[model samples]
Target: MMKNIILITLLAGFGFNLNAQPLAPDFTVTDSDGVEHQLYQDYLNQGKTVVIDLFFTYCPPCIALAPTLEDFYESWGGGTGDVEFIGLSIMNDDFNSDCAQFKIDHDVSYPMVGIDGGAIPAVQPYYSGDWGPFEGVPTFVVIHPDGTVDFDPSNGVYDGPGVTGLLEEAIRETGARKPYHLTGTVTMPGGNAIGSFDLNIEGELYSPGQMLPGGLFELDILLRPDSTYEISAVKSGSYNEGLTTFDMIKIRKHVLGIDNFQEPWKYLAADANSSGGISTADLIQLTKLVLAVSDNLPNNDPWGFIKTDYLFASPANPYEEAYQGDARTYMF
Candidate 1:
């Protein structure tokens, strides 16, 4: 009898001191119903406050905390409103059946995830101290929309409606707000749809240039409201893209001082070697690309985008100018 009691106590959770970081680690989990949830992408990035209950099935305190969480979950739109609730099992061996049984036993309506549902790895950062030390099971973590975490929202009170009020108060203290979205279209010259292009925001690679159906892109990721982002696009493939016999002839004429191009961008396009000016060397590279002798332009991308609002100090020689701003750029 004594041995069995000791085993049960060991199976429950061990106590730990609370010393967690303000920022929560992002994770992904699949619930018993097979619904996938990404901590940052799904909930926080969507401007939702998440209340996560980390517990095990056999624990008594965890059992006591379930009904209160259910009431709190329903009060906050039953996982459909600004607040989201997730029940995660800490036991590595607790599968979906164990979590489902726990949910049914307590009449819990929110998502309950177990090892089979990716709960263990999803909560590993908390217990592993990577995000900071955490308390024992039945711990409540309130994560605001901006990825801030309130590790002790319940403050040792987990049995009444007051606990729910505390959670709400913690959320408000974090000053959570909805996120803004950035949307735009990518196209080639003459308004033609680009096959694919890479997207960058604030010098970070956001998209790996996935193929868009009609070059329409929507960034619904974690974009903060009232924030400025330096967005840029890069599309480079097909060495002969926009290069032709006519281009070679034009460069030859410019080199010989026959017919000078008027636009600054035209000079930029003719600098195939990126040599800072138009010359016979550029005509040579353009000729190679047009004849399929080379598949890429040396020292220059096949296309580059410049903001339409850019100004050239030397209009006759636009290579002497440099402007940094928003614009759809491509190089031909």
Candidate 2:
């Protein structure tokens, strides 16, 4: 009996793990549109080749590659000769809305579904490797028609040529094609060392996993220029505190008193409002200051130059204090 079993095993592929199934794991998830999708029944097991990517929108590299992913999906997704693409977002709490908005903003045409903790391990093969390690976001996995993984695009450096070449080969083999490009860098506010904070972009919050040797948080953003955007950072679940700190970054287009000053100040001269050569508006502003009725005054016109209470001592005289407590300085 032992000899017969050994012969059978040798005939079948001796080194193969007999208990290892060649089939991919099964799962079910709901898309952004509230539709339930079964992985094996509706996609893989039905003779379709699928590409699954695990990511969250707040991840900078993930956001940066979004356009490329969208372009690829549009070219070859959903019944395009047995090829399908899906994005799995792994965000918690408030990040859900942000991820949803990111999909819309980036014009991601494919379905982006949210997976709970129970479903995380079922998809681990796509992210984990035989070396007992896992690659984070922007990971890609190609599932073959026979239900086994044909190519794992994770663990490799994300570059345009390499990614495109591998994807092209996969396309030729599986008849699945999607136009994709790998670009962008992961960056955080305050020079990439955000202490222990997470950034929130378009409502999605991202925590910088573990502090590296440099004490920088894991918050990185991938972005393209000439695009309208807003980004903020928080201390994870402390939304209220995070919101306050995030809002403190005031963005203004004009300078107050100095041309190159970096610190905040409380005053500007009457002539400072003139951007396109002083006109009637400037005179009107001066008149309001003189009459102590200027609506734009920070805390009542202190100079009283408007009231002629103070006069210029010289043609090049520096601006005098407008009020008793006003210590405003000029920035030139």
Predictions: Cα RMSD each: 16.8, 24.8
Candidate 1 vs. true structure, TM-score: 0.48
Candidate 2 local lDDT, 1-332, one digit each (tens): 00000000000010112133456667776667666667788877677777777677777787777777666555554335456777777555413345567778888767676654223544555554542235577666677666666544434546644554565456446543332222112222222322354444456665546655433233223322223334333332211112221112121112222232132121123233423232344444444444446434332222211111223233222234322222211111
Highest-scoring model, TM-score: 1
> Candidate 2, 201: how far from true, in Å?
50
Give all candidates' CA lDDT scores: 0.66, 0.45
Model 2, CA-based lDDT: 0.45
**What lDDT, from 0 to 1, does candidate 1 have?**
0.66
The C-alpha TM-scores of every prediction are: 0.48, 0.42
Can you tell me which runs of candidate 2 are displaced by over 4 Å? Answer: 1-22, 77-81, 93-96, 116-122, 125-132, 175-332
lDDT of 1 by residue, 1-332 (tens): 00000000001010223344557888888998888999999988887888888888898888877787787666556766677889899997788888888888889889889998888887877776554457687777888787876676676776667677777667555454323234455554344565555656566676633444544565534433334455666665666765668777777888899999886667777777777788887787777777778777768776665544455667786664432322233211
* Candidate 1 positional error at 44, Å: 12
Candidate 1 lDDT at 311 equals 57
Model 2, backbone clash pairs (residues 3+ apart or across chains), number = 9
